[model samples]
Target: MGPASVRPAVLVDFGSTFTKVRVVDLRDGSLLASGQAATTTDTALEDGYAAARRSLDPPWDTARPELVKATSSAGGGLRMIAIGLTPSLTVEAARRAALGAGARLIATYSYELTTADVAEICALEPGIVLLAGGADGGNRTAVVHNAGLLAGSAYTGTVILAGNRNAADEAAALLAAAGKGCAVTANVMPRVGELVVAGCRDAIRREFVRRITASHLFRDAAFPVRMPTPMAVLKGLAVVSDGIAGVEPGLGTVLAVDIGGATTDVHSVGAATRRAGVVYTGLEEPHGKRTVEGDLGLRSNATGIVARVAEDPGLATRCGIDDLDRLTAASRQLAAHRSTVPATADQYTVDAQLATAATALAVGRHVGHLTVQHGVTGPVRIQEGKDMRESAGLIGTGGVFRHAADPESILKGGVADERWPSSLRPVSPKFYVDREYCLFAAGLLADDHPHAAFALASRGLEAL
Candidate 1:
């Protein structure tokens, strides 16, 4: 527990599929050793963590550290329900805040919460509920009503009051009086057409850590569990975009695609600009954003990805998957045996194509596009999602990218797809891989030693 002992630290990420540990020289951001073990989801994850510790034998096995930091995506991550004044304004902002904090948004209710809505939320059993409505000085009726409804429900999880400032105190008091845990933060939509997420994002992360700490699963782990795996990675990505001294100066705009067994997540950090004559009509897109595609994955959601591909002509053919039945069967087999690695050339090909499709689909959905239509006043353009044409880097992570012989090809193919409705793409950018799975670890380090975290992350990746 001394400063010298803290020089060497252990950083672990408890992912759904794997438990990874890294021993690092915090002084210079040097990686000493790393190990991995299959995550023990049904039982305590400590078993896997211990196994991983043993796998890093000899010096590391016998060495003592001053710190044990962890980030996790276990148990489907942090599930959250969001309730807001309207679907387009406060509701959307609340959803963004939740997602930015690395929470899986399970459900969103707009306007006043109904008895049926409360019943469904109870059934869903989210770890947290994000209640946001109105603007700073705007309408407070909807947000206050929703708060009272949630307080009277069977749900007893943490409820975050992030709405009209005038009503937040009352909402918090009502929830407290009802024996419900409540936390208050700044309004998600402080003003009409303006989205403020930093406050709610931080609050959500704190509540999620509190919820995770209270669970028996994390009882034996380290304190100050920085954040969820994805959130940490997002923070690390932000660092990459912003740069740190003695590390990367900055990458300008960057896009990252992480393909997991159950979902594909896309994260981007930078400014979004309209190209030529296109005009964005929707709410402003946050510079640092994350989007999770639940139905696009290699294992559990393989069939869903296949079905989407089937809907698109020439996609299967481009992927060299001619037999739809064979592909579907293969996907089901992978789903049933999630740990199985491709043992045959055909299987490997199928995996690469699946990875390609998943990446493409995720990016396509994450990026904004422009559409032309006639308006009462004149012809207008509508834009949706974030524009990434000016991105300076494209990074790929996770099992698919890590195990592939030519992972860059998968990313290249995905980005080159003509089906993309957006004018901006990572058409030309530096490519890198999270070969050592240090993204989350770097994120965990960012809070205390930002420069070291950036340097460690820079040394961890290799150009693809």
Candidate 2:
């Protein structure tokens, strides 16, 4: 298409604190302009979106884009609680599914639900309850019992049943009798040591979209907000990692860490590199995986980050946090005023330290680690989770990284060093920053315009 004939697309992200807007050229996937405004979820999402639109540069502010797509994390995002039979197998599977679906997992309960557990679940009032237990055709008692408990509780949210196939009907019938909303999907752990979460993830996405559409903020037909913000970022990262067949060259293995107000999310896309003399255990890691560290946030949960750093002296040293009392005070102040930006040098240092610590902790939990097991012959090495040591690129998102003077220093906190030989973190990754915050935009365009999405990701990711 000619340059004059080329159109532009508008992408929006309704984050908890800020509503970000980006305008991109549909022809070459080049970013044209961007704007940000405080999110007004309590009032109306449209208000914030309109303000962001008005802040755009030049023609983008006045001209109407050919299409508008949005992703949101407003109103505390999609809050969910996961219930499963076991902590290791089913509960972990449920957690993965919930995180992959872009839901903030508030709590997780294992085994049978007690009265206290049900009460806590009711009090939390999560938008969705992911009920998963046992493999297909395995134990059915726990799942069925949990369903009955949920049905009898004061919780009025949707219950997603992703457990034993044998007990599906009974559980559905129980929820139906109680007039509770339930979505039945394939078991998250269909068999022992197998994790199949795509079905549950899809179900959660459906519920999320339904919730968004039902809300007054997204009632306008002109604005279509589809997936959650994290989900969009995940999709965009996947596209960058695994390029379109015969169209673009993939970036091979890649990692992205999004540090936010309430959580820090780590996403990796690529296969775990097979190594010699290493035995894989537990569930096989998904090609596209995401893990959210609820306690590792820069704003709302800054105190948690400070506490974590204080607990681990090595982490504190690595993050260059020598003054725990100062960090603690700053974290408390930042938590109290969530919108406060780093003004003084001390505040900037505090933010950097928190970001570094959060990146290190979150990525450590997300990546796999090696352990030695004594076998018949000798000691054998076992690996659990993905090995991301060979990741081609590491991208840092969020305000901390985008506005930092040295983003590479914060990004390096997640890299594996000689001190932790077992961690499977990227050792020598090419660092990049999402300066324009166009990952969501690329993701929104990926399905229909693969080439454009790929081009956009390639251009938008600024190498450090």
Candidate 3:
């Protein structure tokens, strides 16, 4: 068959504010056209989807694609609460699995559940409760106790049991007796200091898909929402970082940041390469890591960003803010008017400063750090988190970067410098912009058309 005869596929991302659509030629993974419309999540999602579809150019707008796939973060993504036995081991493991699965981790609790904790969980109303504790053959008492508490609680979310293997059946039976939804998966930490989250991640994704399909918000949409928007982006980054063997060459050690209205998500894919004389500590970092900063956002959390900057005078000055009071007022206005675009020069400057501060703070929290400890012989450097200083490329996405006149300057806020020699942020990496917003689309195509996904991602990015 010739290229002209090959049918394209339509990919849609139901974002919090916008419904983005892309048409990709299945033959070569080339993007044909793209369009976006204000998301009608408060109403019918199909209204926005249809509008975006109609906004496309030429026959592409009218002609039907071969297949349609979708992802969504319209209703604040997949909200989840993770509960575990210990803060350092099981709790941390559950946190990683939840975030890596593209879930918006609302809260995390350690130790046995108390009455107040159960009340808080009920009030939070998460879509999923990630119950993890103990190792595969380790202490099973905590997990079983937690299961009993959750079963008797008013929380209606699905309980994902990724704790002790020995206690799995009992936990499942307890939840089932209460008529609560439960899913049993592999232990998140099968052994001490050993993490096994793939099964849990898969279980989370399955639950996400099930909820999305069942929700009335997306019932009338033409395509089924397959995964969360963050998950789709993560999948695309995986393909970029670890390309198919002999088909596509992977980009080694890559970092990508997505700054949004309510959060800033940082995704890094690669092996953690420790420098000589540095001792790595803490839980082993995953090859593909994603961190979401709920407090760092340009719109809904603008005030939070301003507050963070106020604590660091130097950072505030670097962001071009002279008066904290003025910036604080501007942040309030931005937060109040979520959809308002920067009209005046001062407003634009405020937005830029906030974006810069958000990126810097979010990335700082995401990357690993080095701490020097003085010993008898010499100072020892201890590294915690993933080392991404040697990243090959840094890609910027989301509305802040997409609309900025100088995105490179905003992105530079995340780079490391001599001021703090501990942060392992990317340095001297090539900058790229997701000009076409095809990363999620590429990820949606990754499972079925990997080569095509790689081709689209490669061609869609514009180097700065």
Candidate 4:
């Protein structure tokens, strides 16, 4: 094929366990052929990419996708531990910011954290450590105290100070003076409830790039191409929504659920609307819109799923306690392993059920936070009139989601659905592919046809 007709490209979809390569014909968005193989984690990347594409694609197309890039949760991604001033205050905001930027918080510490806590943070071997405290100027002492503790810990990684802005520069200098390469960013806790993401996001990305390049583990520079699997999924979904739904689709938000072995991620996005020309009592409206609930995930927090499934009598009656423990454990393994779940009947049933429960739970929490809520024992699908479909696109992702045998199992056939209650809009579910994250074909499409990318984004968004 000539240069114009050749339009040859490479699409790399990095999953937790595997990576996929597709050779495409851009003229009509055709996936002319494809390649897929396990993520060669332990080997040099130059050879690994070569090996993965050896059989799945041809010589030229396999060499580089013209777009030889990717998204992943597999490796070279941020693994962190966050210390917050309050239990569910700054910590929560910090968590959301981390998630939005694609970093995974292995653990979160709130008030009254002790030396044992600092010792523990040092042991996690995370790529980075996020320290956020009482809102700006609110808890300067605690923030400084935590900074002091981290300065002494064995955490050789970068230390990001995201607390009282007034003390930030001093804190950064102090940490630097303490022999730690300090990273200073805007306060994660700009206020009590709202999170300010710009500064920290930049710092995290920079720290991430620096850490990967410095680590003996990443030997090859392929590390920088890694996008947080969730963030990649989020970006892909954003593209899909913009293309498919258009601007004035009357859609309020786009809701996505990624039910993993250890974490379930639910994101709700929509146009920001102010009520009565006045701000509400307890809400952070950014650009008149919002994205909520990163604390409520399925994988690492599987026990939360048990508490949720326990509350739903119908869901509870579906299985035994032994399976709950086993399932959660498997999910945790899945999160750590970061790969596809087998597509078999028995596994499929369990996967679907768990995903449904996680999605419903995450969505429930996100919606309720925008309003207000009780504990997991609360008996409500959503707060009164809170509009679950504010962002109409309902994209389902994660290992189970991409490989699940039947998505309808959780889509609620009607009111008789034993899973989620009837308040949330039942928009048709869809996916975008970041093979390592979940194979929703986002990579393949993005490789073959740039035009179709946006069209795929808006799938299933009835309200948007």
- Top lDDT hit: 2
Tell me how candidate 3 scores on lDDT. 0.88
lDDT of each: 0.83, 0.89, 0.88, 0.57
Residue-level lDDT of model 1, residues 119-182, one tens digit each, is 9999999999999999988898887888888889999789998999999988888898999999
Tens-place lDDT per residue, model 3, 55-120, is: 875436435568799999988889999998899999999999999999999999998999899999
lDDT for residue 35 in candidate 4, whole number 0-100: 62
> Order of all candidates by TM-score, from best down to worst?
3, 2, 1, 4
Q: Which stretches of candidate 3 lie over 4 Å from their true place?
A: 1-4, 58-63
Kindly indicate the candidate among 1 and 4 with the higher TM-score.
1
Supply the TM-score for candidate 3: 0.96
The residue pairs that clash in candidate 3, if any, are none
Pairs with steric clashes in candidate 1? none
Select the stronger candidate by TM-score from 2 and 3. Answer: 3
TM of each candidate vs. truth: 0.94, 0.95, 0.96, 0.74
Candidate 2 vs candidate 4: the lDDT winner is: 2
Instruction: Compute the lDDT of residue 16 as modeled in candidate 4.
Output: 54
Error of 1 at 152 (Å): 1.1
Quote model 4's TM-score: 0.74
